[model samples]
Target chain A: MARDTAREPVKTGPDYLEVRLGIYRGMVRVRYFEKRAYDLFLQNLVKGTSHLAIGQEAIAAGVAAALRPDDYVFATYRGHAHAMLRGAPMVAVMAELLGRENGLMGGKGGSMHLTYTEGNFMGSYAIVGAHLPIANGAAWSALYRGTDQVAVAFFGDGATNIGAFHEALNLAATWKLPVVFVCENNLYMEYTPIRKVTAVERPAADRASAYGLPPVLVDGNDADMVFETATRAVGLARGGGGPSLIEAVTYRHGGHSRADPGKYRPDAEVAEWLAKDPIPRYKERLLDEGVAAEVLERIEAEAAAEVDQATEQAKAAAPAHPGGLEREVFSDGGATWRR
Target chain B: MTYREAVAAGLAQEMARDPSVVLIGEDVGAAGGVFKATAGLLEKFGARRVKDTPISEQAIIGAAMGAAMTGLRPVAELMFADFVSVCHDLVANQVAKARYMTNGQVSLPLVVRFGNGGGLRFGAQHSQSVESWLMAVPGLKVVVPSTPADVVGLLAAAVRDDDPVMFLEEKALYPTSGEVPEGEHVDELGTARVRRPGKDCSVIALGTMADRALAAAEQLQAEGIDCEVIDLRSLVPLDMTTVAASVAKTGRVFTVEENPRLCGWGAEVASIICEECFYDLDAPVRRITTPHVPLPAADSLEDAAIPSAERVAAAIREGLG
Candidate 1:
């Protein structure tokens, strides 16, 4: 079909512009959610220091979008974006940050330990690299029960050096498990730059080669690239081609936690990365490909409105109650009444 | 039946009863575990359910916790309790805290079996009684079975429980023969068993030490002093009611354990007895435990480190007098 070049680019495949536009919306939602979380931290509404995934939204958006409802996903402490993208209630996430009765975990687990088991987002682990092995176990359970369900573990660049990461990769490769290990290489492992501690090169795949699975490298800023790569990896895992690794190259725009400024990162490096932020880049791509600019603006405005309402509701909600503190401590009728 | 056979039978029964129950550990499948506690399981359950792993303790326990959370009942084996140190973080933080952390949204229906205690010349690294450390974790239910019947029932109960159970099997008592009741016997975890009836003193013990306490009680019976022997099957819930009743009747109590005397479960038991039934006691409760030293590799030194029946009897005699 012949189309006007300025508005609709010729040869835009079926659903091409629509898909990119949706991804742009997801990235915008994550950015707004993270910005509000940062504000909540400053006001001390958030119990502990919140780790912001400000610049790493595209990875969560792409991977979660690629997943099926039953497919499991385990993310690290920097996991707000992942949960948000998976459609967890924004008000519950906010209430969890404020440690309220209506929070995701009833205020039991705060920012770093959010869990939405019904959504199959098992948790966001506080410990680095610890959740990888659990992801492997979930994959093994799926395989044991003769299901095509796959498990995905989302961890940071620093987790690659830990023992759990190495053992998990080895076990997954050995058992031929259906899992996708995504390393969000955001340049810094918390405050320390990954280059200082890591022995290998930029792509984490270099290390995965030792475990017998070749890793896929993707431009984490571009959601289209990440979505395509993650979909292919998920396909292989479901079809019993064993586990695969994806090294997503990205950068974090915020500090490791609330208090310290990321002074360890050079200003030139910060400015350079800030210029390529995924939210704006993805938005520009969608608009250039003949997607309406009004759609992008509406998505941003809606995300801002939703997040503002959730924040106010969370901050004003009742704090966690002290009654029945020892409930659910152990199962099978343990009778140690602490009253 | 031997304790080893009881464990295998219990696991087999649970795995057959519930398809979600899975066994994962090193050498647990074809090798049938280091102590043969899992013998014939791989043949019955197949490799997927009765799986073997590398020498990765943390992965073994962590994966069990993971599997349990995702709707599988997992029974993981650590060859020795000493190796649990490697999996401490997974047990203490993840498996123990997951249900509470998630506000009851998730339950770890998992059982972690460890071959615990000393008297075997496995050296200091292999021969630690680690109940002291595992007990400090709040959400974990700790159980140590002395007899084969208790082993079978407690193992079955652990598989059924929604939370994590630290099912510590006494390594030295695995080969000891006993009449374990057949056909679906389940032990209520925190119920203490009264092995002997007496009025002079109450001798409370756990795991293999229960046998020693019985032997000590028998020796005291010859000296015209009667002793009631209590076997505590569970540690966390701690069936102190049975203990308090026995102490109230006997008017004297002695707690026995194989772990070190300094900061041990024996002291916790002694403290509980004092707190609950102190007025009923004729004398201060005594704790018979190993001196503060790592279990040595030599047989002579290992014997010296843990309490013998003679030592247990002596402590009971002193308390009764």
Candidate 2:
């Protein structure tokens, strides 16, 4: 099947350069945060399991850079990057991962369920394909309330086969809802290559025609390309053009999770993707475009320092109190079910 | 008013009062639902609010959760209670845990209503009493209304409340008629109502079984066994205070359950009663429940599987003796 590359022309002006720099900075911040989380996991500071987006930072950064502050974003469990890019405090996200009191959800929700409603980063759903319909619902609410606030759902290539995926796309199309379905096609779903299990070659884009949506395919490693695609998609949605399906082609730099060594893929394939890593490649492009090296270095240094401070704060914070276990089960501020 | 009409009435009252309240389901709009309980809702609320979704339970429930999370108060109807299994993830993992897992940052003020239980003989797949399934889930408030008045009143309360409520309308009782209070009528959740007050024994039941328990109490009254029938309107908030109070007064208790015996709502009630009213009991807490088996399609087999009025009365008499 033919894949449609993002057609929004990249402007070459100071303003556009600033936007590119901002996207690059966003990606750098996410990259630093994820690396710090990986180190914390190794040191046993982060409990349970955490899904990292080490190589997939460009998609979150670019898509989020294109969205307005009030627009909703629903991401999958591998969502540290998405949360940070949407302006969730770095300290809170780090603390949440460490199960500390100052965590995003006061340590109630751990790594997989990061939610910062104040930032409009709706949630990071662990269940695959479940949030697609939910994103549609938020978009429906926006449409109902006469707001231009479009909703965006971010998932991996694996979610395309699930029943909720098809149901949500069709419903969004039928209702003409303002939402964008961004599939970070990371080539693999968990341990297996998505191609082996999925029927189609392009997991998300190939299935777009069935829902009457144009198949959108973008090079996920290129922040500029992702930004342009997302800008058009978000604009179209806000303009009442209904939903868009964009399959961002990328690869995870590490294993599916912390436990796996990612030995399933051929060494040659891993090296190929590593060579095309989005961060270094984008930084080199910015340098070639006559941007000062100090500008890029400053961004990287700031991001690293911010992540370091967050790590220290999270490590020093106390664990969530046990007495609050029976709270927030209902809206009444208590878990009481009886008189 | 009939229980079926009250379904529409309760929805109309809430939708009229709150603009955020919307209805979505399969055939819930122009078709008036498969059970015709939602008739005239589309004409009254218009297509914008009264949405007839495709035959997709996941989408229906997922959309409802999303809407509730944001601003809208959505009421989603699944044609049959058994269909909840198809979209159980949305209810159990997503909607039920969203508010808790998010630390109350997201509150899902939504309601999912379904036609529950066996009497229509729709076979194993269609005729299931699934309040027990939902009540086991922590974040959900499970409501099973026994009469038309309770249907209208409880539904109003469920819609108004800021939580996810699983509203189970007994399929067999949809045609049953009773007087409903005029105008805006709302009842509190987590409260039990005593249909018949007596001192000999307390008979506890849910949904359709409440009527059956009342009938059995009438039969036991004739036999000089004055029974108190308590209808548990909501299962999540088990209303153990009322149940324990009744058990204390009667000194003997019997639970008439339509669900399979194992881990039914009655089991929870029985355990609580034993714990709270251990000294007040004159007899062992007898549970009059259906044998643990799948409901058959045949009328007689279905009738035998679910505790009938005769079966309940006979169990009460045997236990008392």
Candidate 3:
């Protein structure tokens, strides 16, 4: 019950509010960065497709909190949060979205292919459910190497129906691979509502039982809830509990990408979810539980400055040298080279 | 040693030498592989080293990538070259792109061994020389050895390399015998070897066609029309220097392959020779290859579809003319 309490816990005393502020700061960082990224896209500062993780900051902040620095994280196109949470330099990610050379993937991958090997973030894929099998492959390596590392694969509700989703889950279950298949079910797959696609009432979590794997549903809007649930799941995985699927019921506040303004969703539906905005809900919970007003403001001011600095640095980052395109296509040991 | 035994020897010696090297494929373990090239590997290295996997080519390749990325060397067999389409994304995209996409931070020390090309009555699905398709994809090192020694040597080299190598063993060459080294050996990927030396003309051949070229060389020697034969040990990093040098000396060229002529590996070879050795040529470059059509299912029709030693000799004669 204490672990599930709304009040933020501290190691030393009630004044040790820095820990709680850090979580809020991370969520705010992601939130503001995504919001600015969308604005930049409108003005053509960012190029190509951009999957804004606007309302899903809590999911990333919470899930990342449950992971060790060396644990693996694989994500889909809606992956800005996952990249940020996995310890990728915010400037590099932001610059990458802007097609800068200093970006994580050297401006080659644009937004969908962010990679941070040092952070153990394998990579993000644009193809629906394409990285699921790749995540399983990484998990299998972890198991093979006898490391206690666990791999977390993040995908959207639409990916649940892909062949790779079922095959990868089955293989992971069979091998008892230490993996967490996190389905960030935002209730809509692009424009099609999940309810229309499947007769199941609950979520993708309900189908996990079919694979003989445990599944859980949580309030993806609440950072604390997402963190606590993810902690349990990750702990179970590290303890050799085998594979499990966690369905986080969040909502994407922005369009699927910059191209679409989500015209299909009814105005009432947007109003309903916006009323329960994740950041405000968590902020309210923090304040109600007696988080000092000054501490909260300082957190916001610091996060805003950090996001602004990242954006400026991203804008200033140079484009990758033209010659870099010809390099890294193959090993130099006389392999095939496509001219 | 037989071609099959030479390949088996390469796997045996490599697995015996490196504890981290493993052979994972559809029937590579207890079944000694579908072509029996892995015969006795399971008994020698045990199941851990010689692993048999499910029919999932994706899993086979993905597992190989996993193992290769994590310091283990994996030799994955696709059973037959025709099924490479099933794992095309894995081989062409994942394995090939791993090194580059990771910015050379990682090397896929993975070898894909499969019996390629249709000369036998293996039918359409089972018989195909898809080497050109793979050759079209960058970041993949393709080695199609023509003899027992080359098979053993190139495979050993592929296993030791840090790049992803496609070791294409022709289905028809499994029983073809030639002298292989008694011990371990490694061969370079891009270097071509002249199996037979002459001066009348140069015949560039690959895979099974190399053997046919060598046989044609012997036949041409008897008729006083000496022909030089260059075996292209690898397709991707093709030994263009040897080809050019030989073509420059002879002033004539003939490219041979089992794949269809249109956009075939032969076309690539011919283009390279023409670009590099056109001044040295006394006649236009000629190609002795299968017509641009899917291989026929019947044995006689299939034989007609692929280039033979006689066809290659005739092409050389025409180049000389």
Point to the candidate with the largest DockQ. 2
Order of candidates by lDDT, top first? 2, 1, 3
The parts of candidate 1 lying over 4 Å away from their true place are: A1-18, A332-339
lDDT of 2 at B7: 97
User: Which structure is stronger by lDDT: 1 or 3?
Assistant: 1
Model 3 chain A weakest lDDT span, ten residues long: A1-10
Candidate 3 chain B: worst-modelled 10 consecutive residues by lDDT: B98-107
Error (Å) of candidate 2 at residue A187 is 0.7
Q: Which digits, one per residue and each the tens of the lDDT, describe model 2 over residues A127-212?
A: 99999999999999999999889999999998998999999999999998999999999999899899999998999999999999
Model 1's number of clashes is: 0
lDDT values, one for every candidate:
0.85, 0.92, 0.81
- Where does the lowest 10-residue lDDT sum fall in candidate 1 chain A? A1-10
Off by over 4 Å in 3: A1-23, A194-206, A333-339
Better of 1 and 3 by TM-score: 1
TM-score (second chain) of model 2: 0.99
DockQ-based ranking: 2, 1, 3
Question: Which digits, one per residue and each the tens of the lDDT, describe model 3 over residues B1-321?
Answer: 999998889888788888778887888889998999999999988876777776777767776775576667889899999888987777887777766555555668889998999888878888889899989888888889888888888998999888888999988999989987676787777788898888988888888998899888887888899888888888777778788889878888888888887788888888877787789988888888899888889989998888888888777766676
Residue pairs clashing in model 1 are none
Candidate 2, residue A311: the lDDT equals 94
Chain B TM-score, structure 3: 0.97
Query: Looking at model 1 chain B, which ten-residue stretch has the lowest summed lDDT?
Result: B181-190
Q: CAPRI band of model 2?
A: high
Each candidate's root-mean-square deviation in Å? 4.3, 2.2, 3.8
